[model samples]
Target: MKKSVKILLIVLAIIAVIAFPIIGTYNNLVSLEQKVDAAQSNIDTQLQRRSDLIPNLVSTVKGYATQEKDIFTDIANARSKLAGASNVSDQATADGELSNALSRLLVVVEKYPDLKSNENFKDLSIQLEGTENRIAIARQDYNTAVTNYNTKRRRFPSNIVSSLLGFEEKPLYKASAGAQEVPKVDFTK
Candidate 1:
């Protein structure tokens, strides 16, 4: 081949190589975004499972602990807020509210020894605890995805594709204000 033709072929090859990295970066970003979505879905599944358990819990508690309107109302309201949450921040806030409400409800339940020992309530509580653990794990997975995406979007080559695609940083799950406090569990009378 002529010298000019060979030079043109080399230039085309270089352009293709350059294009490959950008394409790969874009694909990686999309995959990372999907992982984040999947993690969020797992968290939601746990939250929904916990939510479904509440009605039975509330009904059981009411049968044993009559006139505890405030605690029940708080739990219902928190559930409503959680159901209505629109974003991660909203969900987090609602989760905190629910946690606080559940904590209060349990504290009040401690007064009723019969209720505490009731097999159904105890079973529900155990299940709720397991769901909470699942939620924590799911949240951690989501945060990991967010961190990975954010790191890529802020770094050199991937940053270019991330910027082009308008990828934004995602928020991580955080402990609520009340959650950070040490429990004042005074079991001894």
Candidate 2:
């Protein structure tokens, strides 16, 4: 080959070598990001399922414990907050609050044995519990995706591509500060 041809061939080969891996990395990042988004949507779906069940549970309780207005109000407020949450952090915090409120509502149920034994209440409680489990699994999946993406984006040559392409870090689903403390349930009222 002539000198000019040899130089041009070398330049093209170098560009191909660098471009292929970057393209692969970019595609991987996009796939991982989509996984994270889908996991997040799953969490929201479960949360909404739980929220939909709450009104029925509350109404069933209302029939027996008409005087327990405060607990019902707390549940309503928590549900509203959860519904209004736009991001992962806000959702986590609101979720924790809703969990606490549900705990308090359950405690109120303990006061009325009839409510606990009622078929509708029992069914709603079971459904709520299952939804909670689904939410937990979804959060776990989201965090796993985030970890994988973040690790890849922060590593060797991929990091350079990630930064150049503006791939930002995804937030994990974390419990709020109050989540550590058990919700207080007082029987004497």
Candidate 3:
């Protein structure tokens, strides 16, 4: 073999050795980002399902307790906030608000024996509970995905490729403060 041909082959081999890792890192980041996005989408879907169930629930409760206007207004407002949320963090915040509103509504329902016994109200309540559980699972999945993506974007080799490709770190879905506390309901009005 000619010396120049051997030199050309050696240079090509070196380029391949370096290029392969960069390509792999870029691809891996893309995959992680997609996973994060899919998880967020799942959360959004569950949130929408919960929002859709609100009107039926409100109507059922209204039939039994027409005087509880304030709770209904609060729930409607919270649903609006959730519907208008633009990002994962915003959605999480709005969801917390909605959950609080729903809890208050449930407390109000306890004052009405007739509403509790109604078939439609019971069905809607069960559906809302299931949707809430799904939302919780979806949020957990989202947070997990965000954690994985952020870790990859912050690591050494992957970070270098991530920065080069403009891959930003995703934020985790954090529970709002006081989320664990039971909402207090006062009927002194």
Clashing pairs in 3: none
**How many collisions per candidate?**
0, 0, 0
Candidate 1 has its poorest 10 consecutive residues by lDDT at 180-189
Over 132-172, each residue of candidate 2 has an lDDT whose tens digit, in order, gives 89989988998999999899999999899999999999999
Q: Give the per-residue lDDT digits (tens) of candidate 1, residues 1-189.
A: 699999999999999999999999989888998999999999899999999998988898999777677778989999999999999988988988888778777886888899998999999999988998998999999999989988888999888788878988878877666766543423333
Return the top candidate by lDDT. 2
| Candidate 1's TM-score | 0.90
Error of 2 at 163 (Å): 0.7
Off by over 4 Å in 3: none
- Lowest-lDDT window of 10 residues in candidate 3? 175-184
- Cα TM-score per model: 0.90, 0.95, 0.96
- Candidate 3 residue lDDT tens string, 1-189: 699999999999999999999999998889999999999999989999999999999999988878879889989988998889887777778888889989999999999988899999999999999999999999899999989999988999998899888998888897666778898778987
